[model samples]
Target: MTSLPEDSPPQMSEDDRDTAVQRLQEAYAEGLISHEEFDERLHQVLTAEARSELVSALASLPEKHPGTTSTIGAAGGRIQRHGVWRVPRFLKVESAFGRVRLDLSRAIIEHPVIDIELQLGTGRAEITVPRDAVVDVEGLRTGWKDLRYNAPRRSGPGEPKIQISGTMGFGRLKIRHARR
Candidate 1:
């Protein structure tokens, strides 16, 4: 067999290809790419032979905002997030007399570690994390109610770790791992 050139582009792995596909899907959902463009780019990402080819397919997509925190607050209404929405690295959620439910089973969480700070008053908050996630509630403080969470038997290597903190007033905070 012939040796490859030194200047050749690096070969794309399955994980790289999967990440490229997820980027294209996110761009399409955000209306950054039209149907035709999404289809074309998706084909390119799937068939990409090198990392450069995959990069070209994902070119022009805006990078995630660094050092920016996403906040969701409700005074008396419910707050919910599920499906394939993007999950930022830092998230702050506040609800006063409102129920908060966050389902991150199918979320696009690019960060290996996510920090969620919650401030709630008199309303229950439920968070369903990814199955492989390792949750840390050490910084969470509760008044008049206990946090309900059963730690997993074991967390796998390289799985995302979610750090939840902040205060809860007169309302229970429940955390559960999503089922496979």
Candidate 2:
């Protein structure tokens, strides 16, 4: 079998693409990229239909911040993340027969974006963000789960975005914005 051409598109997972986009945002936030460059790169990243395109778009970006996976599990108890705390890149939060609250109003977001894999059962997951923070929820394949209120969020460069995904069983996930 002949190998694909050098210009051929590579295989990039959604997570990877998303991470690349986040890096671009971080670069823009750090003043490394001007608004024009940031807008152009972001458009390329978002409109890229192939993995090679994405790789090309990210080639000019700086090295991304190392991401760490953290787990916050609860059972018959309450888990809360509030005040000024360091938010990791990826968080695996599990709540079974308990409640979970993650408040990012005053949290220190080290990365441009954070991904939370929320697993809930017979419990509730409440995520509160500042009025300017952006919240995105996706990839929930829950049966009999009660997911209420997904408010639309529009994020920009230098803004914090939280991408929450996972499964919930007979539980509830509430994402609300704090009142000023």
Candidate 3:
């Protein structure tokens, strides 16, 4: 079989094309891309006749953070992270029984959004976020005690959004914004 010209677009495998489509979907779902942008990128991916075209479709999208998750666990005691610390993109906190406290008031948060996943068997968990931060706990599932968080009347622009998710078997979760 005769090969095409050197400048011709290289062929893309089905798996590669599917991966590009999935990436575009994720970017749209994460609010990284607008509906119109997703549609455009998706169209480019679907109709791309070459590898370079597929790459262009996903060129500006950010890759998923790898090894950016930090897990903190306690079997039956107190677990706490306070004071000045560097927070990861994703944090998983697990405690079997006892109190857990995470103070992000003075922590270094470099991301626009961070996720804190809590899996507690019993006891209370308290989280203190930055004064300008917004918290979203809609993904959290609790057994008895409901989450306690008093949202501000309005949030300022450019503040980070903290997403707290996962299951809590028992005990209360109190989230408060920093005073200073």
Candidate 4:
């Protein structure tokens, strides 16, 4: 494999380089960068060709997302919710500065066959479900603290079980599921 040039951006510190790469990947996945832009910038970073390009890309990313300022409820913080509860799929909730609390206390249960999945990252996450909701959780990984679960006993015959798998860093995770 070819190597980076000697004068490429002073050889960024390992930690700084890793953080930049992670941010770039997250921005690409969140649609902040187009496929072509992502590919070109990733190539530049990997080959150490245009370090300034990476900086420019990172600077331009936040401008595209336009942070919102709405409060979710008694949560007393900014909570942005996306996706609908229709089918079994993935739900990703992320934050950098504040905690994320998912209060499913008011969710309407029309069908007794719904499955919920969650992915938490970089912040505290609290998920609350009702006593009769059937949930299967997966990929639950946390950092800085152990994952905690709290919920009332299940009212129905079937227990709401959680199948967790994933990793969290520098934060705590609390999953509240009703037990049968």
Candidate 5:
């Protein structure tokens, strides 16, 4: 990993190029990428196209180790769960500018109440709730024109409803709430 200043723009150094090649090799070995395709893509990564693609791919990769809090938005982004361990629960998610991923499939709420408030400058946001959870949406403004919203089906819900209300902007917002 090439250690660059946090504020530095996304540019690949010699070390970064080597790291990308290494990852590509690992991916090929893991069957995620074919040897031939990996060689072709590796060439591309060493060229100009690698700049944006590599940065985006790296950004989307999940954190390797757990319990490692990211300082990217350590002060502004948080997930607060308030209630007892019952069939129903209340979850409030608040973010100034960042992306959020929620999995309600593993949740054991009899009744689920969700409230979301997002102030996204140029970030992405996502929310996933049980299909039985009621959904309410509002207040979305985007700085750019490429805003996206995806609402899928519910996976599992013993007996819970979901409610959502919020405003969004030029970013993205996805909600998979219950069908109430």
Candidate 6:
């Protein structure tokens, strides 16, 4: 077996580091730092091990901007949101005899708390999120109640608080992690 450093966190993506470097370059070009300072910061950004480390390295940069309300619908079809995307504050989902997949593992969540109103009628719905997110589904008005809960849902800092509400009928609503 192999052992890693006790202080070392999870490895971050190279693209994340590259983006940090680009931000540093932009800041330097904007005269935010001198050449010598930029070089030093660039070294630190390139060597960051964890995502948190890289985020701290670029804390001075602007955060991801918020998105407006978005409504995604599917009628006898499929609707999916995966990869990198801007999650709006309010999301209205409609699916009738269709499939709806909302993957938020790598999504840019602008608001800490998100409101989702689902109108699923005789359709399947799947919500994929990061492992740390909290999902609430008690507001769903459905008679078909076959539930599976892997972990308890709670809200806190750095945790996406998603509130699910509205009408659901003759369909399955599954909430799970992206890794699973």
Off by over 4 Å in 2: 1-67, 150-157
Off by over 4 Å in 4: 1-77, 80-89, 110-119, 134-138, 151-155, 158-165, 177-180
**Cα lDDT tens digits for candidate 3, 54-112:** 88888888876678889999899899999999999789999999999999999999988
Ranking by lDDT: 3, 1, 2, 6, 4, 5
- In candidate 5, stretches whose alpha carbon ends up further than 4 angstroms from where it belongs are 1-90, 138-159, 177-180
Candidates in order, TM-scores: namely 0.63, 0.60, 0.70, 0.40, 0.37, 0.57
Q: By the lDDT metric, which is better: model 1 or model 4? A: 1
Q: For model 5, how big is the CA root-mean-square deviation?
A: 17.0
lDDT of 4 by residue, 34-144 (tens): 889878766666655444544554555563222221122222244543233322222344455466766555544343333333344456766666556555444455567
| Candidates' C-alpha lDDT | 0.84, 0.75, 0.86, 0.50, 0.48, 0.72
Q: Is candidate 2 or candidate 6 better by lDDT?
A: 2
Better of 1 and 4 by TM-score: 1
**Candidate 5 has what TM-score?**
0.37
User: What residue runs in model 6 are displaced by over 4 Å at the alpha carbon?
Assistant: 1-67, 152-156
Residue-pair clashes per prediction, in order, are 0, 0, 0, 7, 20, 0
Q: How do the residues 87-110 of candidate 2 rate in per-residue lDDT, one tens digit apiece?
A: 887889887778889988888888
Q: How accurate is candidate 1 locally (lDDT)?
A: 0.84
Which scores greater on lDDT, model 1 or model 2?
1
Regarding lDDT, does 3 or 4 come out ahead? 3
Better of 2 and 6 by TM-score: 2
In model 1, what is the error at residue 30, expressed in angstroms?
26
Q: Per-residue alpha-carbon lDDT of model 5 for 1-180, expressed as tens digits? A: 322235645765676666566556445533565677777767766774435655543343222233221222322454333223222233334566556665565555542343334444545666555555555554344456443445444434543445444444556665554344
